[model samples]
Target: MRQPSSSAPPPAESLDAVQAALGAEHAAIWVYGLVSAFLPEQFEAPVGEGTTAHRARRDTTERLLADAGQTPRPPEPAYVAPQPVTDQASALAVLVVAESDTAVAWRAVLERTDDKALRTSALEALTGAAVRATRWRRAAGETPAARAFPGQPA
Candidate 1:
């Protein structure tokens, strides 16, 4: 009976979690691109920025997988968006939800890992998500929401 090796399972990323989170990140990257279709002309810059940020995180996640000697799973063909983003209003709503979900996913990673760098990255992602959510809410003609914020606390 052979025993399992003690390689520390790479450094961070609960593969189970990474599978789900990676899917989320991938979806977010895709959603950000589509969201622009529904955004107002005034929102192009901000939404573009958010899209770029998501793209950066997507790239970083890929690097994490490579460093761990694991190939990240491909994202599902599609994800169930919260609702149809047919206009600026719905686009903002979708953006908020996307950021919030991303934050939640990163928080789960934080719980599943002890790597300081990963922890820091998770915090960064979470904080960015919270900020984006607030911005999205404001963009959608709403007031700033509560302070609970999404994802793990700093």
Candidate 2:
């Protein structure tokens, strides 16, 4: 990634971390779309909300990368789900996995950056994903829906 023209450009490692977060955002958006068909009409609102949230985050991440003089990585044509989403339960499970992945990526960005603004952004992203993951887990009837230490490796 090219350094920003500003005198206080973010470190390359931080930029790379942000890029990874951006990629996670892309995957989350894709997963949201993919799960729509498998979900019931009762899930329509939540699915739309999830798609909107991920799209907004993706746009913000792309802008951040552009401002840092890095070309944002494009999303893959498709993403493989953790398991077959043949029903609502499996679909919710995949959503939980997507949000967990997003949280992990944002946490990596937080660890790699000393930039206060970036840290704040990353923290918000991580928290949002963690909450979403919890919601999905609950919807899937998983016990202990809330993660005690979100973004930490199990």
Candidate 3:
């Protein structure tokens, strides 16, 4: 039998945490574009709001990383959606996933950081993601639209 590797887990340092958040923000922004494409015409307002929110968060995360002397990860020119998003239902599903994933990244940052301001920011990000995910779930007609713990895996 092959032995398992014994490398140490990656450290949860501030710079690394911020970079992870930045990556999540980038992904969220990109996914919002995909979401907008398949959303119904009536959902233009929500899609626009989601896109603007994600962009703002991405910019803030990049600034935070740069201020800490860390290079922020850039967004991919394009991303493959986890599922087919050819209809409104699938687009809402993808939006829920994107928000949930972003929440998880922010939660990780919250777990790793002791700084008060960073903790506050992480909390806000997590809460915002949870709210967005819930809205998307409701729009998708999914049951139990809200999770007790937003970032933790189901």
Candidate 4:
């Protein structure tokens, strides 16, 4: 059986963590696309915002994967969503959870990396996911989803 990773300082200059972050970026792009379809036609503003965010993430991660000499894995045909999203309320819920998951994966890169630039990139990714999560939560009349991140709250 595989052992779990610890908080020990990561191996030097390995791009593995960054590669894993790219995979997460891929999944998030897929999720955002799926959720966008659930927005009402009158909510063009939110739909546009969501589409832009996902596209930027997908494009940037694809470039990072290429520049790092890694091939980004394509997302699977279907993913097991955390829950069913049959309406606006449920769709916002999915968006919130999916963004949180994306943040968690990007945070892993920050934990597992030594490259300064990669760490900064991971931080940016985390911030963006968090912001999107907050926006969706507000749209759904839910509390801000931000919480103690990278570690449990004290």
Query: How close is every model to the real structure, measured as TM-score?
Result: 0.84, 0.93, 0.89, 0.77
Alpha-carbon runs more than 4 Å astray in model 4: 1-14, 150-154
User: After best superposition, candidate 3 residue 121: deviation in angstroms?
Assistant: 0.5
Across 12-40, the per-residue lDDT of candidate 1 in tens digits comes to: 44655655567678888878887888766
Give the per-residue lDDT digits (tens) of candidate 4, residues 1-154.
Answer: 3333533333534456655666666667677677767878766686677667766876777776655555766767778778887888888888777777778778877777776776887788788787878778788887645565632112
Question: Cα deviation of 141 in candidate 2 (Å)?
Answer: 1.0
TM-score winner between candidates 1 and 3: 3
In model 2, what are the clashing residue pairs, if there are any?
none
Check candidate 3 and list the clashing pairs: none
Model 3: lDDT equals 0.83
Expressed as tens digits, the lDDT of each residue in 1-154 for candidate 2 is: 5544655757899999989989999999999988999998988998898899899989999998888778999998877887988988889989999999999999999999999988998999999999989988988889899999899866
Full-model lDDT for every candidate? 0.75, 0.90, 0.83, 0.70
lDDT, candidate 1, at 120: 85
The predicted structure with the larger lDDT, 2 or 4, is 2
Q: Candidate 2: how many backbone clashes? A: 0
**Model 4 TM-score, all chains together:** 0.77
Question: How do these models rank on TM-score, best leading?
Answer: 2, 3, 1, 4
Best by lDDT: 2
Error of 4 at 43 (Å): 3.7
Question: Each prediction's Cα RMSD?
Answer: 4.1, 2.2, 8.5, 7.1
Candidate order by decreasing lDDT: 2, 3, 1, 4
- In Å, residue 83's CA in model 2 sits off its true spot by 0.7
